[model samples]
Target: MLNIADTLYRWCREARPFALATVIEVSGSAPLPPGTALAVDTDGNAVGSISGGCVEGAVYELCEQVLESDETPVRASFGYSDDDAFAVGLTCGGELTVLVQRIDPTDQPHLANTLEQASDGVPLSVAQVVDGPPRLVGRTLSVLGGGSAYDGTLGSRRTDHTVADRVRALLRAGRTARVEVGGDADTCPEKLTLLVHTQAPQPRMLIFGAVDFAAALSQAGHFLGYRVTVCDARPVFATAERFPHADEVVADWPHRYLESAEVDARTVICVLTHDAKFDIPLLRSALGLPVGYVGAMGSRRTHEHRLERLREAGVPAEHLARLRSPIGLDLGAHTAEETAISITAEIIAHTNRGTGLPLSRVPGPIHGRVPADEAPAPSELLAV
Candidate 1:
């Protein structure tokens, strides 16, 4: 899982034999989604979670069985309908398909390196055969970036090449899915199900003001698992002491710093510098980029003036539509901490395509299903 990458790396490096249970598929009102993992060691210790709390005891027992027995990877299904078959059932009426496998460091040495790369914010994907022959069930193959070279194998060389190509395509698109392979004439007639888990670097949140609200928002971003950066032209305010939660504090003009910053479609830019000199140039650049959210802090009157200035600066109408000048949601927040919460909530809502509406008013599952074509947005991975 994303939250336990570092811990998993440590366990792998220590050569500790552990059993890993990963949620490969979920439907209905499942608490967790695919790619979430739980690990159990020989000592009965565990890290991470698949279900919020329900079915954990049963999953832990299954992990223990994998570690103690000679069973191949086990595909366990739990749901309300399976109550008769499985004593452990989800109370939320959701169905979950999990793959439990014993991981030996000696057998899968590349697993440690994979975990280490993921922990260090390198994008990669791991494809594990979960269904088919018992000998192929636990086999894993990993592809880093868009490179053709892959580590490990899924039984035969032909199967490994096929899985690696699919994984590379998924990595390029930044998606995770369960794909079936090896049913064609060139390959084995028996199809095997492979659960591909794509691990992308954490999304970044760039706050271009070092005010008190910016400090609070930086901390909130950190809590939401964002690699936050606080930047400002004023050295005194942009010091790391002021924004200890930020991953980096830089004293530079917002536009100039962003000029060389690494950004992607999942990046969020918060322009808290209310001044025209700093806001206009920085926002002009931010609005043109393909970032997820761009918000600027200001009042209604200030928002209008900013719009006029942006229009005069030749920013397109569509680009202006991307900016949230009033910044946070309508929380009636006055304190910096409260404003931070409001802003963070808005960011989460935007990432999930939510209307910022109350859960009581919204229908269907509270968690939205992200489109497979899009990158794994921050809200999708957030353990809310």
Candidate 2:
């Protein structure tokens, strides 16, 4: 697929009139989510996708009309219907709305720049006019260089600053939200679409254990699209020969590694170092911070001992609850490979908070599974 942001930027640079179509809202079996966007130029060329080929052709026609029109950004709906007419409806019985508008070259320089940054794989949010203030209307604000700074405005400094700060935090965690500000504070109604881009790539998973189980778990984590780092304090065990699939195999103390490193909610710190000598101090350092997942592998007795040790060390009960003792779902896994699946499943369940049921059980449209041949090439994990 073409890079949507880059395509739009290049079109703008070439003085080409284009319309950006974004799936603003979706319900029931949507092929694309709310933030999914597509760009279509006057030449019938397009990038990105609003649907899985079901609605793209129809949306393209609308984009072409919007590009040729003088009307402002407009919201249009598309959904499945049983009227024996309207053959272009979604076959999956899903509904989606597309917000199409001509890119304001004069007002969208900053938006273009932010889109350019996004093209470089740095995620950003572009808040343009769906229909609001003229100056603030079609403005784009981007959070880059690790702070909230934008090239344009939303007319009001108060609203812009508040939204930027809140949006930046949400973007850091790869989320998109639509905010309606100025409830009682102002006269005009401002509708701002906050699309928080995952500026950086996927989150990193540092697995500080290179055992047989670690190999299986690391592989499973890789499938979940994490940059896996397998480290062990023992040099003999921490070798590329054993875990050739791991992204990083470091021979370092787990406690020292975590203590000096920068960590956030996106980073997962899994301490499979079954040894209390190694696990205790590592847990001590990890619990002190807001790391995403801190799971330690141990039995009921082992966790009991660890709990007492943590309490004696003055660690609060609330903080101790953050740790997932015994690690992984109760899958009754016996072998190392099976245990790894359970662990990875638990991680997914925690991340999505899924009910762990069959997809058929849910009332939604079934999407075609991505064939194995079309799947993304696996990154070489020999080195990070």
Candidate 3:
């Protein structure tokens, strides 16, 4: 499992065979999502988690059984049981289907290589066949991003091609998914099911300004698992001492640095430089990107002026609408630290499509499943 890739990889290299248990499906409320894995080495040692803590002991024992078995993958289902408190079950009234399999990394070097890549922070996806053809169970297919070739196979070239194509789609979206591929008469089953786990670098949080708000927001962004960067033209204020939480601080023109920075659909750009000289050009570039969120800090009057300037710079009306000027939900924030909380709350609310109203005012379950695009956990998030 990528969650314990570093530990598992070390175990494999040490010639210790281990059992890997991964949650393949979930029904009802689950604290941890599918692809959450728990692995146990030969010596009763365990790493990672299938549940936060509710079912770790049960899953750990499952891993032990898997290791003692005939090296065949099996499915273990856990569900909430109102009848017995001692039963192995989830307390959140959810059901999970975990697939357990044993691996000898020396024989199956594909897993070793995948874990190595994950430890090194490479963008890739590893899909393991958990169902369908009995013989093909545990077969793996891994594909690296950036139009590179895939390694390993699902028994035949056809199956490999079919799974690899779909894996690319999930890899591009950086999602963990359970998918069933259609039958292949040769070297395949009627339906081959897999758990595809994607691993990518941390999403970027570009905070444009070196003020107190940017510094406080950098801590919030970092706590949320984003790679935060603070940029400003003033080198004196942009020093690492000023923005210690930011992963990097750049003393460059905001627009010039953003043009050169590597960003993707998961990036979030925050403009805290209220000055028109910097805000105008920087926003012109950020709003055009397909990043996750774009917000600027300013008053209502300043927001109106910013819109006028962006319009003069020839930004389209549609792109202009994408900006969340006077950024953040109305949280009655006064201090910079409080404003950082308000702004980060807006970023999350936008990503989750929340209405910024009290949960009691909203209707529906408190815990709901969001699509991968709407809520993607960091690929590198540690489950331990």
Per-model tally of clashing residue pairs: 0, 2, 0
The Cα error of candidate 1 at residue 62, in Å, is 18
Write one digit per residue (lDDT tens) for candidate 3, span 1-384. Answer: 778889987887787898889888999997788888888888999888887888889788778888888568888898888898558888888889888888877767777777888888787888888888777787788887431458887776656766776776567556788887855353233578888988876778999989989999999998887899999999999999988899999999999999999987668899999999999999999999878789999999999999999999999999999999899888999998899899989987776555566666544333332333443343322221
What 10-residue stretch in candidate 1 is worst by lDDT? Answer: 366-375
Error of 2 at 159 (Å): 1.9
The prediction achieving the highest TM-score against the true structure is: 3
- Candidate 1: lDDT of 104? 86
Q: What is the C-alpha RMSD, rounded to one decimal, of candidate 3?
A: 12.3
Instruction: List candidate 1 segments past 4 Å from native.
Output: 1-196, 368-384
Query: What overall lDDT goes with each candidate model?
Result: 0.83, 0.69, 0.82
- Report the Cα lDDT for residue 22, model 3: 88
Question: Once model 3 is optimally superposed onto the true structure by TM-score, how far is the C-alpha of residue 185 displaced, in angstroms?
Answer: 6.3
**Model with the higher lDDT, candidate 1 or 2:** 1
Note the residue pairs that clash in candidate 2: 123-199, 129-138
lDDT at residue 265 of model 1 (Cα atoms): 65
Instruction: Work out the TM-score per prediction.
Output: 0.53, 0.55, 0.56
**What are the per-residue Cα lDDT tens digits for candidate 2 across 317-379?**
888988888888898899999998988777765654343445455332222112233323224
Model 1 lDDT tens row, 233-332: 9998889999999999999999999999998766889999899999999999999998888999999999999999999999999999999869999998
